[model samples]
Target: MEDLTPDLGDDRTLLLVDDDEPFLRRLARAMEKRGFDVETAETVAAGKAISTARPTAYAVIDLRLGDGNGLDVVETLRAKRPDSRIVVLTGYGAIATAVAAVKIGATDYLSKPADANDIMNALLAKGDALPPPPENPMSADRVRWEHIQRVYELCDRNVSETARRLNMHRRTLQRILAKRSPR
Candidate 1:
């Protein structure tokens, strides 16, 4: 892969915000190898501080951080540096949140397990050009499981409430939640 340095001019700084420490470290290293000066934060407070103190030219933020939502950080970065490219990554991808992220100034919204290449492509994509389809798109089963999980979380982990909202039997919902996620 070619370095993105020249394409981005001198502003090669990148911010990576995620609650997953291992993922954050790995992504930071990958972005650095791709010619970015990377900085990482594991909480919303830290991410906000970095955005306010010294905004980067590009950012990849996890949607659900330990302290707060990543959209707040995206908004701050956008307000501080309007030209910055921001991508929101989430394990629980949903239409509503994706729209909200864009409205808050994110350049793109991607589902979790997205690779460094995907993130780089998102940041450097041309105006109004749609990102290419993911090489290994999530399976239908996986998508369904993710949706169920999202609803489960939204219902505050109340199994009965989630089942009711999804029009599913409580026992069935419990069984699904008990199983591991499909690929």
Candidate 2:
């Protein structure tokens, strides 16, 4: 993976924002090893401050921060540095959010547990390169679970509201939501 280091790549300053401290630290180290000067923030406010203080050449932001959506940081970065390449990484991935990220100025959208090499590839891809389809598509059960979780989050984790919006029984939604995420 070190071979992917951008010797001449425009990866000078990289802003990494995510609420997951462990993930953020690990990713920051990985990016630093890849020849990027990594700057990190655990909250949206900190991220916005960093971006405003010193513009970065590239950014890798989580979809949800401790305080707000990563889209907010994306917008701020785009406004401050229009040329900066920004990628939104999230554990909660959905078609709607992916579209919103792109429309909000994210160069790419990636699901979490992503490796440094994968993130680098996404950031550096030329127009000719397109993201490959999932190696193993989600099962129907997994898809349903993910959709339910997404709706649940959108409803602010209100079981009744989520059930109402999803047209599902409250108890059924509760049981499903209580279970762990599907592989």
Candidate 3:
């Protein structure tokens, strides 16, 4: 497929944050072809550093990160570069998270593996050049439930550990998971 990444040269800049290195490189290259000056970070810490150090026109952040939540990165970007549009992408797409993202000022939320067109559409929509995309093709609630299951597995079913890793309270995590589990 033709690269849709913008070529910014020295002017415009776009920040891409994701733990997936291969995906990051491919997306960055594609975005670069579309005319944006692309900068990539494999972790939330690196994303924060880039946001603090440079001016960015837009940011595409993954919802989960190795060191921290992608939402944290979105929050940082919103605070540091309010004008820079933010798009949150997650493999575990969830309505609750999507709502949270919008509440935190994300311009859009997407589910992975998102394509170049998805990113392009989000950017254009943020600039008021287009309308919001259709409702997520996948069920957000189901995705959230699956994510909770993963967390539970990782924590060995220890609610506290899962909550700690997710940056949520033990009670909250338990409550969410409880709701998802069958009767």
Candidate 4:
């Protein structure tokens, strides 16, 4: 495969993965202006495939994907392209999740509503410093479980309310929570 990392005239390439089309297009254009040859993927599967086929200098991944967690994509990239730097983004930002992404080999994490400049700065700083390892790995399932618990708590254990908040069915929520609880 051809080199996907842009030269920037300085020799670096950036890969961006997000399910948001508008955001991905805008960010790609912006990065192109800054001389980054940006390769984009709209799903975790696509991102993993692309990263596996290409040599990336850096990667920016969204935490939530259409098919899987963004952290999973980052993990695959980290394992496949160890020299590439990775930054994870999320709209549902949580310290625990961010730490988990880092623990899984992300170079940094950014909450949603991040600006282009912030993204650029992060990409530029990719190789300058390394983030400390996470205290513990956060399983994607565990994070989802925590989200379910928080929603249940907020809804006062009302399955209907929790389901409404989660955009799921009350029965589904009940089943998930039941599975999470001890027998």
* TM-score top scorer: 1
- Considering lDDT, which of the candidate structures 1 and 4 is the better prediction for this target? 1
> Which portions of model 2 show Cα errors greater than 4 Å?
7-11, 131-183
The number of clashing residue pairs in each candidate reads 0, 0, 13, 2
* Lowest lDDT 10-residue stretch of candidate 3: 2-11
lDDT of 2 by residue, 1-183 (tens): 237476536548999999999999999999888889999999999999998899798999998887998899999999999988888999887899999999988889988667887788777676647655545666778778878887888899999999999999999998998899888
Angstrom error at residue 86, model 3: 0.6
Best by lDDT: 1
Model 3's number of clashes is: 13
Candidate 1 lDDT by residue in tens digits, 1-183:
555443666889999999999999999988888889999999999999999999999999999998989999999999999999999999977899999999999999999889987888898888979778777887999889988998999899999999999999999999999999999
Between the candidate structures 2 and 3, which one is better when assessed by lDDT? 2
lDDT of 1: 0.91
User: Where in model 1 is the C-alpha error above 4 Å?
Assistant: 1-7, 149-165, 174-180
TM-score of 4: 0.66
Q: For residue 94, what is the lDDT in candidate 2?
A: 81
Best of the two (3, 4) by TM-score: 3
Query: What ordering of candidates by lDDT runs from best to worst?
Result: 1, 2, 3, 4
Off by over 4 Å in 3: 1-11, 126-183
